[model samples]
Target: MEPKNQTSVSEFLLLGLTDDPAQQPLVFSLFLTMYLVTVLGNLFIVLAVSSDSHLHTPMYFFLCNLSLNDICLSTCTVPKMLVNIQTQDQSITYTGCISQVFSVLVFAYLENYLLAVMGYDRYVAICHPLKYTVIMKPHFCILLALVSLLLSTVVALMHSLMLLRLSFCTHLEIPHFFCELAQVLELACSDTLLDNVLVYVAMFILGGVPLSGIIFSYVHIVFSVLRMTSSKGIYKAFSTCGSHLSVVSLFYGTGMGVYISSAVTDSPRTTAVASVMYSVVPPMLNPFIYSLRNRDMKGAVRRLITAITSFL
Candidate 1:
């Protein structure tokens, strides 16, 4: 019932992204709007993909998975943060904090792996067109999705279990908007030499590995595109990757930017602002990146828009 090693800190006070009480109202409104956009955007992608038979293919199937993950990831952090802001209650229960940490990691890594998988799907569709339908059958698509979900869930469980074993010291304020791994590790009362190693090692394994997969898939895709006999053919090959390319860039770029910005700025508020690009903006934009840019998705959206308006 109680943590043995440290004084029982019932609720951790999140020293939020800023100590400037003046900015709390502004930040609350901004994040509240972003949260609504993230939810509505990702949810619409799932609904549109599911409702439209024309959109039921390997690409959209993986897309729907990404949209769902984005929604989950955003939900894990943003709403609680907004409530904490408006109520001026920067408190989170021990159980609630841990649950958010675990859920956020699960969906964050899920998006990473899912993006890589979707990249591979595009590789098949564009470079190996003749075999696209056969290779990316309905059962096969479901299997890929299930595997990504499995991996994300498994990793989240492992990391959370490791955290449970560790004890925290008196310092409980997380520097960033959400409980980032590095920030939490800094609060650990017990010897965290192993935990730090594990955390960075995970940063490399989960983050580095999927990132490599995305890069490698694109390399082969580029090579295949170049060998094409005609300009039109090359254009067609590049077009297949347009949506995925944007999503991958948005996710990794903003995430890496957060680290790089923190290295330079050394400011908690700056890091939190950069983190918003990764945690909030990407999810809000992913559906549009896919739907607005991809011709097929554009058509599907048009139909869904028409159908919804018809009922209204």
Candidate 2:
């Protein structure tokens, strides 16, 4: 091995979401708008959860954590992406590259686990209504959230640390918009067995664990719902879970689409476009989804709007 090869790579090229000069400004403006929406929308969720005493429950606590994670996740990638587009430079310093990848991994995985925990929360509330509070105590909810954070951090650390060690002596061009782990791994000059293993491990931890938990919770929920004697009761019970189910579907569906698209397609531009749905669409839409569908959220929004108008 050459000394030059052994030395760490200090920078990387992002390649961005596209190569078309015409599309650069369009993508830049679009993401700038979406990034602002993601931040403001999640901030609203956090505020709604915090200000509304009626919402200070285990479920809302998890939701608050979720909104926080969504904010972090979007902030991790979007600003740099916008910069790449506007500056006409697709370069990222090695430190910045690693930081973005780690932050995305951390918060993305947090959403997965938080959503799963929310499913379980709904299960307890609906299936075992008698003991919902006993089971979903404040301490338990906080602990679950903290565990999600810890788990995500550990998995991200594993991948980032391993990727950091492998010097990228050449092939600085990253395939996708951001410093995605897969794209970064593609840029490595050394053998990537370690990187590959770390990525696979991260996917398993992030995807498999939460998915399994959600499945089990839904199974129990279905059983409970089926046993209901009244149609209205069933409808009402299912309604309680409607918002959560919507988020889960959108989040996982778009996420899986990105993964499958990357696997089946070779075009970096295509992958970046597909990845946008997962990264940008859900958080941007969540506030609307919940606000339109949830009465409490609607009321909170009304109050917030009224307060602002009065101030004006």
Against the hidden reference, what TM-scores do the models get? 0.94, 0.95
> For residues 74-185, could you state the per-residue lDDT of candidate 2 as single tens digits?
8888888887777778889999999988898888888899999999999899889999989998888989998989998998888888887877766688867888888887
Tens-digit lDDT string for candidate 1 (1-312): 443457465656677778899999998988888888888888888888899898888888888889888998999889888888888888888778777778988899899999989988988887788999989999988998898889888888877777777777666777677776666666777877877776787789887998898898899899998788899888777777878999899999998998899899977767877888898899999988888788877887888899999999
Candidate 2, RMSD to the unseen true structure:
2.1
Least accurate 10 contiguous residues by lDDT in model 1: 1-10
- Clash pairs (backbone) in predicted model 1: none
Candidate 2 deviant stretches above 4 angstroms: 1-6
Model 2: lowest-lDDT 10 consecutive positions? 1-10
